[model samples]
Target: MNTVIVQPTGITPADVLAVSRGGARVEISDAAMEAMRTSRALVDDIERAGRPVYGVSTGFGALANTSIAPERRAELQHALIRSHAAGIGAPMPAEVVRAMILLRVRSLALGRSGVRPDVARALVDLLNAGITPWVPEHGSLGASGDLAPLAHCALVAMGEGWVLGKDGARVGAAEALHAAGLRPIELAAKEGLALINGTDGMLGMLLLALNDLCHLLTMADLTAALAIEAMLGTDRPFQPELHAIRPHPGQGVSAANIHRLLQDSQIMDSHRNDLVHAVQDAYSMRCAPQVAGAARDTVAFATEVAARELVSIVDNPVVLPDGRVESTGNFHGAPLGFACDFLAIAAAEVGAISERRVDRLLDVCRSRDLPPFLTPDAGVNSGLMIAQYTAAGIVAENRRLASPASVDSLPTSGMQEDHVSMGWAAARKLRTVLDNLTSLLAVELLASVRGLQLRAPLTPSPAGRVAVSMVEPFAGAPGPDVFLAPVLEKTRGLVAGPDLRAAVEAEVGPLR
Candidate 1:
């Protein structure tokens, strides 16, 4: 990937993904650098005037009324970062922290935070050097943005925190910076506050989840096609005309994808005229496109929210065009928090309906005469009975996670932040929800492919064959049950991957 130029505007989800995961380099545009200079000059003039401002001269949070002399103003910034680095729990994923750093850079580059140009450059350098700060999972209520988490990221730049080592172990920030041919920065005036006060953490995770969930939603359609072919379910419901009346964009797209995947299928062809084979399939079979399409729509909605947030400067007390430094609630994470929780609900429902499909494929009566539990000898070998159980357990967990985190608010900073967004917690839960959805889809894929294999004389669709080919190694020939854990475990990795979609898409053009 080429270097991502950070301007005051035009940042996108793709840029974030590139820098966060694709190792793309970041640079501030000349226009942005000039804007920063202009903004900083105003701050310099304000500091010289010796007037009380929310972030520049006075204290922060509950102590905003406390006036400070010029000499101690630099110390105030340092102390803000140090005191707010109160996060506790396991460290966030390396990608998440990298994304947080990238977004903070973007915010500063927007020239609204009133920080010197080097503040943004130092963050860019840390990202280019791959120095991931150890940000704890907890501590952000999401009102004044992700304080504790971004504070940890700020601490690394100040040479006062820990970073992930070459071996993924925790190493001192000073040592990591020195090894990376970088020097620590001393934050002055509003620089440290600018670094930490934003919705970067939750917003970054939300973007990552949307990226990953887009693929999983595709897999949801892919696996649904596999189950339809394996169970000899009819594709009449997926007809373009049937979906045309409803006119939901995602529903039509999903229905078309399933229709394309089911083309030239011997199974669907054999039962094309056989009326009693399945009069009308169950809702799980009939509504695969509906459920999966809803998820795709939710991803679209969340992506829009993330897109707007990507270019937005979420810093407090932003520097205005009129040379006025004023405090604002632009740092509230409610928009992001609601988006995160909404996607989780959508993903969990996809997993919910996917679990139902797996159950149908396992039961002999419901599976159109695929063997009980998908084993050659039903009574002796337990087969994939427990795989469904594992999927069910995950689906249950997803239900609990689906409860919106945005509504659960607890005051922090001694009620100075009386209401919180809880967006960070929602973002964390969304990651787990997507993880569970991937595993559940894997279970469906494993069981449904087994069903396809049992019906040997009747061949499946070409895309179905490609799916079977992918899972065949883990799911050997119709036989007694081996250690099923490793099979499902490895298959989960496959479900989370892109190869299956690529192979199927290669055969059938492309899925939605």
Candidate 2:
């Protein structure tokens, strides 16, 4: 992949994926360098004049009022990072660490954090050299700027903590830097504070989740289309004029996608005149667009927030261009916390509705004459009945995970840092919810595709046929149950991937 040249203003979620997961190189823009230089000069003047700045000459949090001597100032910065690097629990994935690093660099590059140009350059060098800092999952209260987690990242910059080497093994920061021909940065006034004070961790996870959901939502629409065709459900409810009356942009988009996917379907045409068929399908089959479209809308809202955060300068004491150093609360993770929780709720609903569809596909009575559990021999084989159970269990878990972490606050730093934003917790739970959602969608795809095969002779829409073909290699033809778990697992990969969507899009233009 080509390098992602990050300017202060144009870093998209796509750019984040490139650097975090695709091994893309990074270069700081010249304009950003100039901004950093200007901020550094202001910090220099503040330090020389012996003015007690909150994070520069003075201490932090509860210690903000306590001034430090000139000689001990740099030591204060070093100690701040070391003490705060007390994060516990398993380390975050390397991709998350890379995103955190990239976001931190972006925030510092905006030139309001008052860090020297060398500090930003060192961070970029670490990313370009593929050295990922070992940051634990815990220790971020999501307020006072993800202090513990980002501190772990800052520790590696000073050659103190550990890093994942190029071979993906852990190594001391000093050894990794040496091998990469990199040097550690010495501490300067407000530099350490700048490094560890931001909402990067929570925002990074949110960005990643947002990107994943963009694909997942479309897949949901495709899978919904497959379910509707398999169960002989009508697509009239998804018509544009019907959707326009209640006009949620996401709803309209989702309904259109389902309508387009089911266009020219022979299965619906074959059963178009069946007198015994019900007037409307169940909510799970009929209201797929409404539920999934709401999620699409939520993802769009979260994307806007993530975009603003990408260019935002988040630090405790911000340095303005007019040479004023002031303490501010821009580091609070409440916005990200709310967004993550909201997405989790939206994702959970999508999964819940999908599981309902899965349930309908397996129940013979509800499925309208399909085989019980989709097995050839109903009594001899259990079939994919348990798959519905698994989806149900995951959907239940998502409900609990969707509880807002932002609503819960605990005091820290001896009450000086009270009312923390558990945004990191919210972000973490959001990841789990999205993961479960992928698996949930996978189970639905498996059931729907199997149900589609039983209705063979009566073919699906062009788009639904494309979806079926994409998963056939993993899902296989319907038969008496044989080691069903592996098939479902493999189908999950297809549902959670781009190939299925790519195939459908290739034939039907594109889905919303």
Number of the predicted model whose lDDT against the real structure is largest: 1
Instruction: For candidate 1, give the lDDT.
Output: 0.89
Q: Model 2, 1-512: lDDT tens per residue?
A: 57887675647788889999898998989988888899989999998998889999989998889999989989999999999999988878998999999888888888888988889888889999988999888999998878998999989999989987656667899998898999999988889999999999998999999989988898889888888888888878888999999989999999999989888888888777775553688899889989999999999899899989887878879999898999888899999999999999999999999999999999999887789998878988878899999999999999999999999999988799889899999999999999999999999888888888888888888876876787677667877677877887788888887788888888899887
Question: For model 1, how does the per-residue alpha-carbon lDDT over 1-512 read when each residue is reduced to its tens digit?
Answer: 77889897747788889998899999889988888888999999899988788888888999999898899999999999999999998888899998999898888888888999999999999999989999888889898999999999989998889998766688999999999899999988998899989899998999899999988988888888889888888888899999999988889988999888888888888888778775799999899888888888888898889988988879999998788998999899999999999999999999999999999998988888788899989899988899899999999999999999999999877889999999999999999999999899999989878988888888888887887888898778779879888888888888888888889989999777
> lDDT values of the candidates?
0.89, 0.88
Error of 1 at 484 (Å): 1.4
In candidate 2, position 194 carries an lDDT of 93
Position 191, candidate 2: lDDT: 91
Whole-model lDDT, model 2: 0.88
